[model samples]
Target chain A: MTTSFPMNAGDVPYSYSKNSHLQREVLDGAKEMMKEVIIEHLDIKNMLSSSNKFYIIDLGCSIGPNTFNSMQHVVQVVKDKYHDNILEFQVFFNDHVNNDFNTLFRSLPVDRSYYASGVPGSFHGRLFPSRSIHVAHCSSAIHWLSKTPKELLDEKSSSWNKGLINYIGASNIEVMNAYVAQFEKDMEMFFNARAEEIVPGGMMVLISPQLSEHLLKFFGSSLLDLVNEGKLDESLVNSFNVPVYFPSIEDMTKVVEKNDCFSIERVELTHPKSKLVDEADAKTLMINLRAVLEGLFINHFGSKIAKEAFTRTILKSDEVSAWMKINYKKACQLFIALKRK
Target chain B: MTTSFPMNAGDVPYSYSKNSHLQREVLDGAKEMMKEVIIEHLDIKNMLSSSNKFYIIDLGCSIGPNTFNSMQHVVQVVKDKYHDNILEFQVFFNDHVNNDFNTLFRSLPVDRSYYASGVPGSFHGRLFPSRSIHVAHCSSAIHWLSKTPKELLDEKSSSWNKGLINYIGASNIEVMNAYVAQFEKDMEMFFNARAEEIVPGGMMVLISPQLSEHLLKFFGSSLLDLVNEGKLDESLVNSFNVPVYFPSIEDMTKVVEKNDCFSIERVELTHPKSKLVDEADAKTLMINLRAVLEGLFINHFGSKIAKEAFTRTILKSDEVSAWMKINYKKACQLFIALKRK
Candidate 1:
């Protein structure tokens, strides 16, 4: 694949994180869905008795913007409905050591009126006071391995061989399953931990890059079509490694099913909502491909060379240069807003 | 000082996370107060009824048996109260990208019925769906940054010095303030988003690592005492690098006041429940740190060195090695739950 080594280290699937652009679109879409689910399901009123403290944690709190979104929503519910400080709020923002914490906390608020602290540890393990937390949330970050699932790298096992096979075509089911199994296990640890950490009736919201053939078709078909047209070379397209691992919505559902602590409240699989546009706009809209492209170029040429290549490609591509409008994912989706059992 | 780099990079105060060495004294003692507060101010039943589609996202979810306790409690409550998957639960397992996701997930149930996912992000910003999650629950994951606040690197800051000096001593107040500002912003964003994203009356619960002299006092007169006793080294203690940016509980309440969306439900700083003692052998226990110690040592010593040093350190001192215990910080500790406006 063209994506660089970081792709291997950070690979989950459909890796778009390195994309500096389109973040707004992804962020906006995820936020909107979350608000809808929270409002529809949980009644923040009487529940948020002005007299109780509320807790919320965000796992994989990358750059923490989404964590902020989740907590702000909870605080707003308390203030607007209860209109009192009777309910204390504690929001825990957590992520791996490699995460950009400085960026995460650089602009945090002081005044300590509401409790905020770091729970340093893996979510798979215990990271809380028993039954002390209320709501737990995370988004766009779970597909990563806590470790490399390194054992799976045995390369000797049928699973390993299947995983390592040349990219014959679509997501190799065997490989996908292996990856999904790991994803499932990762989630289990996360939920089980929450099971011990959250209070009854607490909620968990998860917004992730959903797998939709229709949306992916746009990515895949378009890429393949470009390759056929010679606008994109096999090497170039091959170099584009999607950083995301999108288990079928069904598989994702099954992964959740593995945990009894939380039940699935919703499963959404709709094309990501982006502004409508023409082919030209769609090319630029391929902003999520930045990470994909960078990783590719870096692997092919090295950072410096990759940087130059990325610039050249963006600057020269008529495919991207063509249209004058914007187009969002035809079917990127989200789901799994749940409550503690 | 020896704690390691970026104190909040998921390092347990003592060293690492372990379930075997739980000193129930702290949990039990804290529970007494928790029970009273449960009776006096917080009403879990009422809160549960009101909260729906809320999520409890735990930052720094660790591995070990204790991890699932919180979810287990919630499940029991649900079984007793609803006996159905009426609520949604999403367990977000999180930590550094390099954390042990495999191990963390190993302990999680693989039932595929629970809503589960991994959140690869930080808490200092938005990590959940915008305003969508009801409760933001985090236990023992704050106070530590995903890493140290970055401004400390500014040459002009003067707040940062060179060499060993960098490793020891509390981080610059300016850096802390920066983190606080970021944290407050995180909170503000949370509330603001809650106003828009969360349902009215959604709640948040958190169990976090707080910074309070009282908390330190519970173990010793001061951190110095522990150091003097050789329980912790002076340099090692100071070299922790990460700042336990525990904003005062009082300040927390005030900060919430400033927030337009959230109201304070309650904030209590109590010792860890002492009842959480070891019934097996029956003796004083320390913070559960062994299980996680390896990770800590490796984090600081770079694996090979860490492995040797860890072995040497454990073998070298009885005081440091006596199956270390965990004594939680008191003062502005646990927050029962809160509702967002």
Candidate 2:
């Protein structure tokens, strides 16, 4: 279920602070890519002469800590390049309108060199002036579709995502196709909006969760089995579908090629250190998972039952505990950096 | 008596909320001027074609209901012009870095059409990119000098503002000239910075306190006299000088002409409804007056003594009470509209 309600720091403090450790590791990995690709490859002379306002936007800059960390990396790179000019750095932190901007501004790092401003609204459409932004970035975002494909909700349609909250466990091929269709459409809009906002020679780097291209199997699919056995209306799962889609590198690159507004400079898949390795046990994983997916569960089942349901299902599974004990081998993330054509 | 400290909403909430009714009335009076000189005279067709991003800024936008009210007027003017297009209005509320952004954001009106972003900095310098802004508005701010004239503090100089908080009643000719010199420097710098930021055809409207050209005398100069009598040290008054300078229409025009980047479109001097008519009693006026000048008093007399000094001085004056009962006859404000040349 795609939520109109924003995932704000105030509302989902636990999810952002604790459960988002995997996203943080991915951001840490990308800082090297930022230096190697963005700082080295970018036209520094042109940037110095053309303008002093080096505009940088963090697309899904949800809230504090991580957003500040990511912005610091971008600012550090710019400061290294233009240390003499007294460059005015304007960093725009963008998220949905309902996001917790209050907490974000109140907790801003006191030592920030760049001017901080919030750009509220969904990134699936235009949010800035034409040719205003120099660089754009998104981490652990873009996989969430703009909204669920309308076809999946129709009872008469072949792609009806019945009896599942996510397509990861769906047996039907049509259900998978529906999710793919939505991802393609959403990506096209995202690319088109960025093309309009970003200046020529600017760059956009997106980091998102991805499926292993060669692997066919996955772990942790048994928690739903426990849910089906536990108390809840079974048909609620039939109507509920997670809007998040993890695309393969091939699928993402194809969308980038189809858009034709940006030239693909690089694409790579990397495995970030999983939270389950050192920090999370089966019990801890259950709590973290509940923090992340409680929204989805609450949308279908009421909030009163959602926490209890996740607790009952994940706590009873011995396979979940066993799976989490080892460092996860199958999880992957796709990084795509594109230059404006 | 002039303050380096910001008169932020957090620091002077009582004063701004009460004593600032005169400023609000002046802002209300500028609505017609904005329509006539901005919407009617401006090249609206060019603005529509050049970009969908309509950038408006409120320079020295102190926190709260007045900033919101002023912004509402600016937004309304733009909306009336660009009603058909999907205009993305971005309003930057700016003040000194120490200004209360927390209270400002918290008190934003529920129905604002523009996306609100707080820009923290001094407006006497650059705050935005070249050709980035379309229209700018400021109210009751320009009278404030960037800093107090250093000449006033020189003990041997004829310009030394001895035994006074402001140049309004200065006995020495050189003291008045020092204030005028500082005003010219600050205004020139202000114009130069705005010329670099605003688009070629953009407009700037400034509303500020002014001295009536014909007035040879003033009311309420006696309040400071009472303060001089009640204070702990006499030389503190001798060294004190208010940074605020109320320029005549002639003085303002001279600066506007010197900085040729902006052409003067209109200059009007208007009298706002005096506070004596609606909600002010002699005691209330004393509290409000203290609110406005407490920062200055605290700097010279310490916070503990300042409040009690103002209370004791104002409460003892029958002359101050007589002055408050009548509609202020001599108070005047200047409204200037400028077009980027």
Candidate 3:
């Protein structure tokens, strides 16, 4: 589906702005690596477009102070690399059209170095003019597929993910295959769009978090509990599948090879240092997850049922923490840097 | 002052969206003229930069449907002028940082021919990269001075417009001169900034309404009526000078001449055909006026007092209609098209 699924908008208690600390942490952890990647791989002389402007686009930039920080860092690194000060930076903060751009624009740093503009569209398609962008940065956003695969919702299909929210930790191999196929399609679309937008020799840096199978299972169980209690319909659960996919290193490299437009410059997997070690951490994680997924839940099951499901999940934070402690080793954050050929 | 005063936001009863019929009428009148002028003066070969992207910016583009219409018209005109079809259009919708960009983005035409982006900043300064923009359009926005000329706000200045909301009908020559000087300075800043942002052969289209001295007087009388009674403080009225300056044809021509960067291509003044000849029309006019001026009133006086004044104005719609019948001939909309030399 090309339809945009946005995060919670505005700065209410449960808004993405208030609950995006985990995203901030991921971005913070990637900054040094991003800087090094830019320094090592950025061909400043060739990357500058004829307009003498360096166009940097942040795909899937949600409402932020984090997007602002990340974009500013990119500008600074580019500035330091090209000491002549001849190049101007025009940073485009992009997200789904339905995203909270008002908050994002208002929160833009007053003394920002780059000229800021907001591009509202799905990144899976062409968002910018061909060969116009110089650097593309996407963090903690690549995992979201354009939409949940249709097979997961079709009753006739063997891949129907009934009574579950996602393919992660699914008992059905067909369900996993359907999700994997969707992820490959989305990545191909994403890479193809970026290939057209980025100029020759331009760079793209992506920070993607691997799927935490246990967390999805934990959240899925909450909905199943409601199903057992006859509070929610089993059919409703059957129709709802989270549109997220965390790719393995092999999965990503294979896609890049297939696109054949970008040369893979760097591939590294770093596990987040902080884990849900306690109930407090687990509660915070659940809240963050809700902030990101609540819109999807509300869209599918109505707000009342979504609220009940999230409340059930939050109440079982201790179990989530225990599950995380045992499975945290498997969770990984993937960093990939590519140069357009 | 660099502080941005936004138009009424969202689709509420008094929002600018609901109250901008006159603006739409004015724009409708200008579209054919805009097309003719673009056909005659647009140097397509020189306007296209090396990037082959035609950049267009709508300054003071409040939450749009009107701005969208206007920008789309501009893009269409340019496309028709250049038959090669090699150019890409990037349209920037700009307003104050506090503008309701959320509504604007959400309401954007999904099938628009050009890529859309929202730029949040005052247009009085440099907003785009140098020599990047090819066309700049400002409609019903130039009259808003950067701030109420500081002199009008200073109690010690002879130009202090006490007991009046604008210099439009002020009897004091000093008050008029202060407003005149501020307008010239603001126009100079506007032209200089556009000169840097717009390519050498770029075009700027402006639509400004001549100050409605009678309308300002009518609105001022309502506040004065409150002052005559003990309901409002005189000092508050003294501190409130409306920050709008509608320039005469000669006044605007002089500023364009002084800027010396653009060659004036066309100057036309058209009286809006629809007049407030009856109470119904007068009431509609009052609501439209409220949408445009309520933010300024609420900022100066509190919301209660502002509402009270607008109520009093609406209550006297018959008088307003009568007044408009006599003086409607004097009300003129000015259209100016300029091309960078």
Candidate 4:
């Protein structure tokens, strides 16, 4: 039996396609930002002399319909800049080993100009050769940690994030600090690895989830409330912390400065177009959230219990629907373009 | 319902692993020849100056145990030559879409140094971007034509190879010339495309089969002889031409000169190890032949008829065993190293 779905095209149960609207919005915004960044800061003369192969990598490129657009945009920008000097584009798409590459290949655009290949592995480590990539883009993937921090699991630690799967509405200061510390370690590693891989003057554009330090209205934390009511196992909730964090722009800027290999070009905070939604949209969000979290839940508590927990939680919630209608710009996104120093 | 087996690792029915021994021998010889060609003809200083990402392509890389070895050899040579420079290797593996990429990836050695990616397509047309490749290699491929020449199919054409699946033992001069015309066209396209893709001073090494201009002792033509005996349809034999032809060194050199983009550095003819085998060994050869030809046969005839034809042809052949023992080196192999002009 498989623990995880291929998270690719055609696999309806665990595909990213359902939630890809969020990704698409992020891509469009990121592409526009990338063009502006290239126009202002990119060293075209240096690139013309040293680079014959214009290399771009999609750091967590899940099967396309969206990643293809991201690649096309990058290729178009590079081609526009260097039309006189004949440059070839080489694009690498990266995701976990389990991601559906076959589906991705089948969905490749008929008029694709760049030579594309999939690189299977996590992006939190060294995936390419030193000084090989000219540009790297990751849309809505870097928030995922390599693993859940060990302190979150420790019963003795003061920073133990017990009975919580995420730090969305953590009242405990210690638990919040622990999640922040884990994010720091993960971000440092990500930056250092990419520092070695990306050429000097090459840029990386990252679009990630961010939460306002103001009053937090957790979108998916209602599921955990069911566990608190003894409808589900409390220990299951306590042990099952997600390896994801919503870092502030300040948090990221500091991480970038500490790493010291990259200089920030621009950072912008934006919300997806459909940030605030009605009841029907709220229902769709719940379904999408359930699909994303189901594999982990099933692995921990078996399919039957996990299914019941989700169904009851969503069905019982008037709060989730109400929360969805509120300005979800409160839960924001950050687009950061960093140049290797 | 699948028309062709995924020519992969463990799928015993259609995997290329069995016949890969022939490919391995060709690869070993080619590697030695590549070292010499690089040392003598290659301007190492020019390569070191203009290229940083030393790109190599295996044009017809079938699922490995062999292709991996070929990649390692090329990467090793390049790394050895430029030990001082921080040069990175990017190797591309090309094969038909049906080739088993999963098996190839799985078989990739854990200690591999070069960044590897698979390019899925036929080598008959443009696969890579212009001026991207430094070295390209193909082991025991390129004899396979892009398609059967159209003139062979015409009823009124004197070049009609009636009841013959290939040019082997053809009595009609027009039929022979038709095969030659198709080969010339195919070779020109192949060279011209590569010339565009490869850097000006880059290299391509091809290991291909070459047949003597003598009365052909067809290696696997007994299956067609069954049609001659009225056991199978004669039109079936006539229409079913293998998209493969063995050209002499002169034929290749002439085509290369006509293409006018490459200078021939070295061309040698050598046979694979253990080319001659007894009845037991001959059975393995027959099975290997069947695996290679199964897709074509199934496409022409139904799977049932194709299966039956193969079973009867091999089982009934004592002559095949005798033919195999008679110094099969008469059907020679060509190793050509061409420098891009």
Report lDDT per candidate.
0.48, 0.70, 0.85, 0.71
For candidate 1 chain A, the 10 contiguous residues with the lowest summed lDDT are A1-10
- Highest-DockQ candidate: 3
What is residue B113's positional error in candidate 3, in angstroms?
0.6
Name the candidate, 2 or 4, with the larger DockQ value: 4
* List of clashing residue pairs for candidate 2: A163-A238, B163-B238
- Tens-place lDDT per residue, model 1, A248-323, is 5776677667787777777776555655232334435444444534444455435654454445445444544332
Q: Which DockQ-derived CAPRI band holds candidate 4?
A: acceptable
Which wins on lDDT, candidate 1 or candidate 4? 4
Better of 1 and 4 by DockQ: 4
Write down the C-alpha DockQ for each prediction. Answer: 0.03, 0.17, 0.76, 0.34
Q: Candidate 3's C-alpha lDDT?
A: 0.85
How displaced is residue B127 in candidate 1, in Å? 20
DockQ of structure 4: 0.34
Residue by residue across A1-341, what tens digits does model 2's lDDT show?
A: 33544442453535555565555667887778777777665665574465576888999887667888989888888778666766767888887765666567656787887777777667887777777788899987787788878777677999987656567767889989999998998888898899988888888889885532111112123335534677555555556666778888888888989989998888888776656444435555455445545666677668766656665655554655555445355556788888887
lDDT measured at residue B195 in model 1 versus the true structure, 0 to 100:
52
Per-residue lDDT, model 2, residue A169, is 61
Candidate 2 lDDT tens digits, B58-175:
9987775678888888878777865777677778888766566656765667678776777766677777767667889988778778888977977888788766667766788898
On a 0 to 100 scale, what is the lDDT of residue B329 in model 1? Answer: 26
Ranking by DockQ: 3, 4, 2, 1
